[model samples]
Target: MTVNTRELSTIESTILAYFQALNDADIESILDLYSEDPVMLPFLQPAVVGANAVRANYESTFQLIRFEVQTTIQELVEMSPEWAYVRTDTSGIFTPIRTGEGAPAAFHELFLLRKMGNEHWQIARYSFSPAGALPPI
Candidate 1:
């Protein structure tokens, strides 16, 4: 659906906030942006729904990683009042399991979000691809 100028701006900021939060690695702030029943489409995995589940997913992954996972936004598109998308190029050291220092990897992700309630936007879908190996961090 078409959104007016003001709401459009809000959605745009919300989409941009995704990358901003990731870059900042402020998990609390990111969590505040989500709805109680939001959905998440993580890479090569089953869909995760609800704020609690979404937080759990990230918390589990973050704990395994020796270092933090960060992201940078490459492109973003807000197509409608309830729909928007972001493409991010990411690079960070991550550990799938507990170990010393895990290897660093580079990847890109496309996130699709939907606005819920009266004013909050939450991730509804996403797809990810490994771009290539990144420089050692």
Candidate 2:
């Protein structure tokens, strides 16, 4: 919730909220960023389809490690009025919750956000891959 809006557009702010949620390991806040039917393609994992599956994925993930990444938005394109895409590169460390082992983590992410008529934008599809080309998120 400490995200800064400043001169960012709504879409950018929404994406920043996502990163903040990840940093805080806030499951409900993360879920709120998604559309009704969200799809996630995590590294080396089967595609998570639908809201329930997405929730499960993040819940499982947050239980293992704590994210502390800084995201650099590479591109923000308005594909259409109701749809847009954001490409970001994130780099930081993830600390294992149990062992307290911190590991450097870097990835590139693509987020497809959709907004309905007079509604706020929500993520419809998301994909991220490790910069090293291995390991799972």
lDDT of each: 0.67, 0.87
Instruction: Write one digit per residue (lDDT tens) for candidate 1, span 1-137.
Output: 54476765665576567656755556777777675566777656898887788788767755654434567777767787667877888777655554465677777888777786676777676567667753332
How many clashes in each candidate? Answer: 0, 0
Tens-place lDDT digits, model 2, residues 1-137: 23324323888988999999999999999999999999999877899999999999988988888988999999987677788899999999877778777788889999999989968889999999989632343
TM-score of each model, paired residue for residue:
0.66, 0.89
RMSD per model, one decimal? 4.1, 5.0
